[model samples]
Target: MTTNENKSENLIGFNRLNEHVVFDSKKEMNYAVADHLKSNAAFLRDNSKNILNYLAKIASHHNGACGVLYDTIAERLSITKRTVERCMSELKQNNIIEVVKQYSKRGGRMSSVIRILPFVTEKKAPVGEDVGYPVGNESGPEHPKKPSGSKSQSPSEKDTNLSNPLLSSYKQGTVVASLLYIFDDFRNKGLSRPKFEEIVKEAIPEAINLKAYVRSVCSNYVENKSKFTNRFKKHCV
Candidate 1:
């Protein structure tokens, strides 16, 4: 073969080799993430594990970043929207995911863009071997330790009520009253007052009018009690 023919063959071979390397690297990265999750399962919340799994699936489909809808996730997972919100918060707190953008509208709400963070582990390379990546004792992002008596708020809760006076006006008691009135079936369902308050606190952030939002949620529950029970099994169970 001529010199030009040899050069052309070399270029084609390099391109094919580069493609294989890229594919293998991605496959290995995925395996590493799964291994890290499995190894650290005990330290993560139950809901957080579910959220991570869901995000992983989403990331696989969307090329590393995706928009996550709290309500849709709740509906699909048979959990309350509050649970989904809390799960996402936990993941962010632990440095497992980051919110790329916040969801908002003039009078409507939408999903937030989320990016999953890579899991790091303390695996030392053997002597005289090159691992290509740094291995350290620390894993993931280090968050400052919260002081005692400090309460952590989720991303959704940060500026929600501050911008909306109607949402801020409805206190815990008012919300509970609205829920009780609309959800008559829940009156004798053995649900505790504190749990009700917790749900109200979570739901208030997304409410344009707190009272109306609670009433609507309760009305929906009343209209489809069985579906509500199934959808909110995390709370009911």
Candidate 2:
């Protein structure tokens, strides 16, 4: 038989072992079973299009289902553990496989029992539904009735902006915008307008840190008029 045929036969054998079923004849039936297995495997490999093929090969060696450690798989595949974890997550998301059980070790190490799904099967329910109900409790306890005459205060715009730095920085007449405006006033400023804008764009996501840094620098600049341009240049660069 060809190499592919041998691989198909091995996969079929492993799958049969998972189901705890025995077969008497391995000659005539093997060829047909191998062909069917080969076709399904090809389809999954093509459609899923991920590290699933490597994962499946490893699972096949352990009789179609096993508790696979991410570290071990990473070592064997010569990839990082994070990559293996991501690939496994993708496979789970696509319903190519399922985690049958989860095992945890001391020191908080964890692994999962992954079951290689058959290529052709009835449509299964979403990941955790088979266990019982959908994940979160739909019938959770309702909030207790509020005491009479107890009014809740709505947050002011200042309070809201303080909680979210992005909003705070974008508010009218904020120091962040003022810093940029003041810097643009210098005719021989080394930085281009585009470059300064780019820096601000990069800083927006990190608004809290930028806000703190700008507040401190701007405060110092206000006290020393000669230092404003030099300090802004240093900060921007």
Candidate 3:
């Protein structure tokens, strides 16, 4: 039963929760989830989307992550418990949220601690875990600092740009392209998807306004770039 159905058990239920408020608003959740989907080339149905957004909405009161039972979510969204399980499984499989099992004082299993990681926005990522969050990175790139008395990373290992996802030969190309589409006239001047990644590595080695720079380069590349950009963005939808 929900806390509202009980008078003295509000605190009891609240105790099982984890205070990991990641998304302040549902819109933030949407942007984060959208990026995840695009980056991974994943999809979520309407029902699954409903659950994900609801989790973010309810997280504010519970310090962000919802540590409620599947039945609790079923009741809130008016869905079946099994449906909640399936939707949650989908979210977990997507790496959008991590399900950390919580234990009670007596060591019994409590509601699972769901950490909907704050979407890494254009900010400096955490040192060890690379945990960057927030909408803009006014600061410089988040380079992993060297240990005391330790040698620096090899030239190949240094990541100079943390303002956005870095592109690479194998993995991060889609991620950079996925993020840049947000800006209008996001184009690639013969530089494949991942948006001037090769150029960033050699030319603009700092974490400057890559978004504006991208638009500038694309505009210089061709006129009526929005027509091409709109066409390219079709796949994103």
Candidate 4:
């Protein structure tokens, strides 16, 4: 009773599909799927290692199996559709996967082509690492560890010796350590107080009117160490 039109429109005929069709026989598809999965293996491990094995199984089947679909991914991982959407967004934000949308011939349905890319390397610390105190006052202590072969100087003696400003805090942490880090960062660039303000503005764009804050902090820093500030004026330049 099947007509020519029906035969032509029969996209997937479950009755006619051979048992061998269950396993993918297409070599190129298999290799492409495997390579794509491998490229994003690091992301799988870092974000959700539990989904790695399931993702691999789904990716391995490639006999016209359009890459990785959202529903299939959700089912395989036992995750909700919303959860898959969230994970996909995170992966995209982190540059783990690239989704390409294209039109399919069958009923003009839109299909997504998944391309797994290498894991992104974040340069800055994730959040709450607390590089240093954004605001502070008062003179802090000198570093506990002394330079090799040199006798450790007293707090006042250390201040006098560090007239260059670059020789301030010898270790990390504390307000002094933060200041020393900032000083050394711009030493080669020949930064002044105004230039330092520009860099601070870059870190905090909303602080465009933070000039008053900068002036107050700098004034306090100078007032607390007037003697040292005078000695280190040239170094501050």
Runs off by more than 4 Å, candidate 1: 1-29, 102-111, 122-237
Q: Is candidate 2 or candidate 3 better by lDDT?
A: 3
Write the residue-wise lDDT of candidate 3 on 1-237 in tens digits.
346323222423554342334456656665776676565444676667777766665554554455555666788789999998888888776556666554444545544556564444344345754322222323455567756664444333344333444222212332232233322233333434344455444333333465555556655545545567878899788
Q: Estimate each model's TM-score.
A: 0.37, 0.30, 0.41, 0.29
Per-model lDDT:
0.50, 0.42, 0.51, 0.40
**Top candidate when judged by TM-score against the true structure:** 3
Q: Write the per-residue lDDT of candidate 2 for residues 1-237, one digit (tens) a residue.
A: 235434434533443334321122333233323443464464443323335554455455453454445665676567788877676776665445555432222223233345554333223445653311111112223334446663332222112223233333333212222244333333133444444444555544335566455434444444465577679999999
Error of 3 at 44 (Å): 1.0
Error of 1 at 81 (Å): 1.0
User: Residue-wise lDDT of candidate 4 within 109-167, one digit each (tens)?
Assistant: 33344433322222354364422211111234555675566454444334333322322
Cα displacement (Å) at residue 50, model 3: 0.6
Report the number of the highest-lDDT candidate. Answer: 3
Q: Over 4 Å off in model 4, which ranges?
A: 1-47, 51-53, 60-66, 104-109, 120-237
Q: Residue 47 lDDT in model 1? A: 74
Instruction: Give the Cα error of residue 122 in candidate 4, in Å.
Output: 5.1
Q: What are the RMSD figures for all models against the true structure?
A: 22.2, 22.6, 18.4, 22.3
lDDT of 3 at 179: 30
Model 2 TM-score, all chains together? 0.30
